[model samples]
Target: MKREEFLKRGLGSLGLFAVIPALTACLKDEVNASTNTTTSTVTSDPTTTPSSCSVTNSETEGPFPTKSPADYVIQNIVSDRKGTPLTVKIYIRNVNDSCAIIKDAIVDIWHCDAAGLYSEYGGTGMQSVNLTSVHFLRGRQSTDANGMAAWTSIYPGWYSGRAPHIHVHVYNSAGKSLLVTQIAFPEDVSKTVYAQGVYASHGQADTSNAKDNVFGDGVTNEMSTVTGNTTDGYVLTHTIFVKG
Candidate 1:
């Protein structure tokens, strides 16, 4: 199928069946860092609780080994509404092992500017916007001793067809990619944006996953998390799993 048709059908349905194995091979080059280990924890919010949807099986094991944290690059730094620079932490792990620790994983992240325009891809609708050669909103970060990596970037803006989101690529110690996913915002932002007719056609922005063809695929809520406040842009937090 053509590239446009494939994207239109969504990444999950694309016939890149053979590409999955090749993608996993690219994550073998991540560098592992040794620091004070931190325990993994989950937070609960009564207002934004996730529904009973399983995007990816948290039980699958990964295909690569772990490395050091110093070998990766951390990027996309920005300031919050309080003027405090808040760096987002990202983690690379094995797709199968829920708790398998892998260090030195390389992560490449990119997203639209504050005005909802991507840097490289064309035909996103905003043609007048000068998105070319502007890579300010993109960067790479590696995991630390605690299997956590962070980035400094501004909150992404909302577009007409989609809700606010960030794109992520997770690689292993050998620079092999393990997973490809997008992080979404909390329901609070969705409610406001949807009410304003931003994503109304998608059936209420707050409940986009159920309607968004891309998000409806193998992607899961556990793959990412949205946090911070929307009044001052937003802060999205997600962790990638790597195997050893």
Candidate 2:
């Protein structure tokens, strides 16, 4: 998902950097970053090769995948859920086609709330919370011409065995499944967000990304670039590279 060259050359050529921040601002209650700090680029880790256009890592969608995805095709997934505000911005690119933007791609995302509870499934031997009737923190969006799908959600809380993560399932324009993956948050950012508001009650995640089964290999492509803080909320920008 290398985009440094494209952001500098492609976006700069079309003068899109000036408008990307504005587009991110249109989400209203999603983020509160100043114009100077609101960027729509992937701030890759220096330890990884940022220039490599490789496919994003695929992970399990976890135990609670949406049973009816069509019913939750909206942007704001915060429906009654509470936590530190978080805006997730995902960009889809085609690795088979020279890392070109993949438009009209349907992207679905779901995660746990501040209390480490997922909607639609619980009350069982596995979860034991009884949230089968509610549907929060789950929704879908189609990618725009710029290959971006944004969502207004809250920062996810961690459970015992897994680190805080967002599950993503991508489909093509015709509704063919392309990839099922997960997005990992930066540990420092998660620690900062968890230390505030309702999240503080649950304490930090028991597992680190390096020890988690899904991310134990590496998170070079799955890690998100998170900005902002507990007061103003956080903004996570990540890129998913698929064949399309």
Candidate 3:
């Protein structure tokens, strides 16, 4: 999926809940831009957004679609797409129950490069090239037994009228789509990460989450708890709840 804005971390296991492992988030205290160092610990603090499956709001799929554009499934989708390192963690849970993880579901992710250009398509503004033969920050995968999927890509860049975000698609074993949505990041975190170069030339993001037409309603369960800095690479996590 693509957005009027742009796209789409990693996760670790914590505890047991309802016979399933409870999801926990670990965020770093600070990020050192120069050395890229950080400190982390598991936390269930109020600031963590997707700590449990509360059913994130379904979002609109933007213009560029990779379900048919992307060639296959890949775990590390950072082929020459430079920028701050970002690991995206996706947890799929059943909305009808106590957020049970849904195994065997296919998850697809796509977003702009550090320069804010999308692959497989040409555009104006920040992106001015056709990437039909190029595959940068695009990947697809199936959820593991824990109902979790992860991808290693750079932090997404901004476009117009939208905040910094990522797009996600979940498909059943039969390839039927179950969820279409996007994940958001905090404004402060975006500022800190972008300042380390890479996306600095893009200037400040033109839109805030509140001003963003897509996430303006408030990110709520769709926002991720970002830890680590651009130096140490960022680890992001979010839980997606879909109908069974």
- What's the lDDT for all of these models? 0.43, 0.76, 0.69
Query: Across residues 1-244, which tens digit of lDDT does each residue of candidate 1 receive?
Result: 3432332232333332221111111111112212222222334232221333222333221111111212123253221111212235665545455454456565656655444555534443554565444344455555666566677665455555555566666655454556655665554544543332212333343335445544555345543454443232233456554344
lDDT by residue (129-242, candidate 3, tens digit) is 777677667777677877778887888888777788898988765556788999888787787766766677776688998989998888876787778776667888777788
Q: Rank all candidate structures by their TM-score, best first, as comma-separated numbers.
A: 2, 3, 1
- Which stretches of candidate 1 lie above 4 Å from their native place? 1-74, 77-86, 95-98, 121-126, 190-207, 217-219, 230-235, 242-244
User: What is model 1's C-alpha RMSD?
Assistant: 14.1
Model 1 residue 70 CA deviation (Å) reads 15
Q: Order the candidates by lDDT, highest first — what do you get? A: 2, 3, 1
Q: Which one wins by lDDT: 2 or 3?
A: 2
Q: What is the lDDT of residue 132 in candidate 1?
A: 48
Using lDDT as the measure, the top candidate is 2
Compute the lDDT of residue 117 as modeled in candidate 1: 56
* lDDT winner between candidates 1 and 2: 2
